[model samples]
Target: MVEFGSPVPEVVEALAAGFVSRELLDWGGVALRLTGVRAVDQPEFGSGRVRWRTATPVVMKGSGRDESGALGPRQAWLLPTEPEWPAYMQGNLRRKAETLGLDPGVELEAVNWIGPKRSFSVGNGLKPGAPVEVELSGPPETLRALWSWGLGQANSGGFGWVSA
Candidate 1:
């Protein structure tokens, strides 16, 4: 089932209200009629070790420092196999947690790609990724928010959608 979610309680409430009203969600030349509105309470993901599978690819990136010192993609997409994935995931989680006013203590323990790498055209370039099963550890609040939020970068762009 398609789901729209957020780590913030107010946003969740707003989404529920919109769904109840059968709102039309439109963005970037895409629109979906939000039907089958139901309030599903957040899953009870207790603290400690947890496993989450990405419904969408968990996206990451490497720094691109050109001769002019600009940031783009040194290497288009950062796959889970890359040596930099762990640190990037950690930092990304910290950023998300801090942004949501949650404690930034989530740790990335493991990630296993579950599907072939796929590419999608985004704006002027292509985004390469693959679905991943991730292992993580943190406090209950942080873990809940992580589940509510997602696994990696580009979550706002629909890339890191995950499930417990």
Candidate 2:
């Protein structure tokens, strides 16, 4: 099931289409359902940070270089404490927004990893599925765009789907 702070017809329609087709290109599988959407209280952060929680597990990859200055062959998962987490999420959100012809300058103040972490198998490796709450302060339009599109890598594969 999926939920959002407000109704998003466009996102719902897109999800419905993907569900009916049982294909989402590279996202894999079509076992997702939109049970319903309801209104929720908007969180207020005194520090201009808004909390967000992932409905599905968010998966991210961090790349680095080897000792020889060549690109590393491995991609590592990003924990919330890592400085690269916010940048990674912001980049993905920006890309999605730009693809939909929306503004891509949304600001993600911070990302905090809430506990009760879990993991699931994707192909050969286990992907982490810990619930995350983030601090996002941006324009209403940009916030809406992020809400509709989702927050991190492999959104089509049901990662980083969030509610307010």
Candidate 3:
């Protein structure tokens, strides 16, 4: 079972079925906030399911020299495989911004349907759908948002990553 987070289907269906929010009895009494939904599938792994809820998944697809003058992956997203995945999604500020529709205007040049987390950062001409940007070092709000997004989209057959 996904420890720190709950299943995306349960959360989305609960909310869609007239439950705006629900408390995860398993996770030390933490609450989840959901926004929207999407459909996803992974045919290669023979693991096709519908991902229901969604987080405004964000990815950056450009490369430029920052003030630090360092080179890094041009395209990036809040991936599920990252060690910081849970913390990034479960922050307070991120949730607040998500609820407020504060999309940061960044876009992912490339995206993968069902592949390794690193595979999510490939391609070009991608765009974000009302995504919000929260700092990696944000507050509790940021983690909260990531949590909501992750669990809400985790096993969603109709959300997040899809396989075509």
Candidate 4:
């Protein structure tokens, strides 16, 4: 369950050889023992079209506007149906790309509703965790990163885990 680049061969090697054993996984302070490691990455796309399935909920955090058109007091959960969802999600992706040293031009093409929005409880507040289909256009490397790392915010919280 590690989102790492291919250039990190030393980590790959260590994990493959079982030289890396128990380590602290930051997700909820869970500790996992490494039995094996597998490499999975989306291949370079030629058509600039890639499909993704959100295996976990994609967290889109955003603020709300008050009835008088002023910004809300606190940030709240944003759903796929919201008008600004795309831009908000895109910003998250771009930041991730920058962090990963990849191009930040990745664009979210479209999202298929598939079904109604899903709600997943995280800690106390309810978060959107609906499983949906998405299409994106970007550099192959960036797309591969989105595939490997998932999408939207709070990825470390186990949301937005997608599969190509």
Candidate 5:
């Protein structure tokens, strides 16, 4: 993810050129791979909104700050069955879009839990990985951007990587 940040197109081109290299590119100790992507039918809800689903598990982390300007412990997990999950994910995506100077009207539609949630040790503590599919409806361009960039926190760390 960090490798694909600024100057993304060039980085992607370089990676593609070295696609058959014996050495694999690793991000924070985790090896990375490039997968083929395809566009699927955008599910439509009763409200006439089109939505897209994720093909990979999305990892999210929530945290707060203390009065002394100290960072709080990170609580990472997947909230597929929670009612507030959509709002939470939407907020993160919206913030990212805004940061990129794009005003996308994206909204989370449904979350389908695929179970087998597990936790893994990250930088300082544990982070949960829940394999669940989500449906999000929004502008085609915006959705495409999100699909390529990713969703939620720690995206550069390979979290919240989504697909359509």
Candidate 6:
């Protein structure tokens, strides 16, 4: 029962992919199945608090039932698609630690995505509005790649990455 708490199409897609679960509370939808959840804490809006750590990425799955009471094939979206991308889990701290010649392999307990506030427009000046502030935590390079991947995926409506 991963709580997505977001409705962004890509995020929703990720949720649908079993990466996260969109808590469509306002939509009057609830998952009666009641399962487990892998929660990743994100900021309210536009907070640069990144929390990337080397851990198992959450997996998603289909859970029929939506806020509108729509029942069909659906899934929870998990993040960090592959288990090989370790940098996204450990942000600057790990990188900096490694750069400084320190043991980056050391574990850091607090790491999650950093959400942003004041979302202007999505793709091609399309406004999807803004939900809550989300915190995305990952190494600079990995985070950038994620943004690029997400945008590309969103723009193409197929598959790709988005970055800043």
Say which candidate scores most in TM-score: 1
lDDT of 5 by residue, 48-97 (tens): 34444444456665444344546667443545554445667878878766
Specify the poorest-scoring 10-residue window by lDDT in model 4: 3-12
Give the true-structure RMSD of model 6. 18.4
Per-candidate local distance difference test = 0.77, 0.62, 0.33, 0.70, 0.57, 0.33
Please count the clashing residue pairs in each candidate, in the order shown. 0, 0, 32, 2, 0, 44
Model 4 residue 18 CA deviation (Å) reads: 5.8
| Model 3 agreement with the true structure over 30-143: per-residue lDDT tens digits | 554445334332122122112222333333223333437576656333444344444443442244446645432222222223233222322353332222322233233333
- Give per-residue CA lDDT, model 2, range 14-74, as digits (tens): 7555556643233246454444334443333335335678777677766654445567667
**Order of candidates by lDDT, top first?**
1, 4, 2, 5, 3, 6
Q: Model 6, poorest ten-residue lDDT window?
A: 53-62
Which regions of candidate 5 fall more than 4 Å away from where they truly are? 1-11, 14-55, 63-78
* lDDT of each residue in 1-164, candidate 4, tens digit only: 55443324464566555534544344457665555556654577767678888877777877676445678778767778776678888888788889888888888888975446778777887887466688889888777766766777776677787753
TM-score, every prediction: 0.82, 0.64, 0.23, 0.73, 0.61, 0.23
lDDT of 5 at 81: 56
C-alpha positional error of residue 157 in candidate 4 after TM-score superposition, expressed in Å: 1.9
In angstroms, give how far residue 9 of model 4 lies from its true place.
6.8
Error of model 4, residue 16, in angstroms: 5.5
Angstrom error at residue 59, model 6: 18
Model 6 lDDT tens row, 9-118: 36645655563353332323653443445534333323323433211122212233455657666432223332322333344335434544444443334324423222
Worst 10 residues of 2 by lDDT: 37-46
Higher-TM-score candidate of 1 and 3 = 1
lDDT, residue 27, candidate 5? 57
Q: Could you give the C-alpha RMSD of every candidate to the true structure, in order shown? A: 3.6, 6.2, 15.8, 4.2, 6.6, 18.4
